[model samples]
Target: MVGRLDGKVAMITGAASGIGLGTVELFVAEGAKVVAADIQDEKGAMLEKRFPGKVVYAHCDVTKEADIEAAVKKAKTEFGGLDILFNNAGISDRMSTITEITAEGWSWIFDILVRGPALGMKHTAPLML
Candidate 1:
């Protein structure tokens, strides 16, 4: 059967677990090649094994521009170009109260939530165009 995403390529961050992992599964099932980017080396390796040639694991920390850049490059090199960028790397603070959140916690959340997606876009926009 012809899949909807046949011949397309996607780069998905936070792809080692949770929603990201589910997305990877769905994308590959739909015939899209995926670059699965995450800090979880062990799980990422598993994803590669599960999907074989359809999924390439990229060890990426979204807060870092270099990591995001490298993942995008991997997509380009492996799949020839990028068709989608899912900036899904994120964190939820475990603090019970607003006052319980420390400056460091805020920084971590912001870096992952805001900076990560921005960098993902920055690196991926060129390839998307």
Candidate 2:
């Protein structure tokens, strides 16, 4: 039987490790062409090596629009067209309360967790649609 994602192209951010990495692995197993974007160059390289042609890596910081754009572009250029985008890049602040958080701390967490995903969707939704 053919794989469910045969001929589909997928882009996954934060894919160097953890959930992103797991997603990439599963996508590839299902025969989707995958672009794995992350800020961790070394780990990204390792993933590329492990998956060979099925997985490509882009060094991306999801907080930056340019990086997100480039990653999406790379997926299209490499795999023809984007069919799925997994905007899973994020960071968490383990701090206790809002009052305990400094202004800069709030900004940093929000930039990574909220703004980054928002920007990824803003850029990627059009492509997917």
- Model 1 clash pairs are none
Predict model 2's lDDT versus the native: 0.87
Candidate 2 residues lying further than 4 Å off, grouped into runs, are 93-99
Question: Which regions of candidate 1 fall more than 4 Å away from where they truly are?
Answer: 93-96
Q: What is the lDDT of residue 66 in candidate 2?
A: 95
Error of 1 at 57 (Å): 0.4
Candidate 2 per-residue lDDT, tens place, 1-129, comes to 688999998989899988999999999999999999999999999998999999999999987889988998898788877888888887754654866889988877888888888887787777678
Candidate 2 clash pair list: none
Cα lDDT tens digits for candidate 1, 1-129:
999999999999999999999999999999999999999999999999989999999999998889998999999999999999998887754544677878998888889889899999989999878
Per-model C-alpha RMSD: 1.1, 1.7
Compute the lDDT of residue 62 as modeled in candidate 2: 83
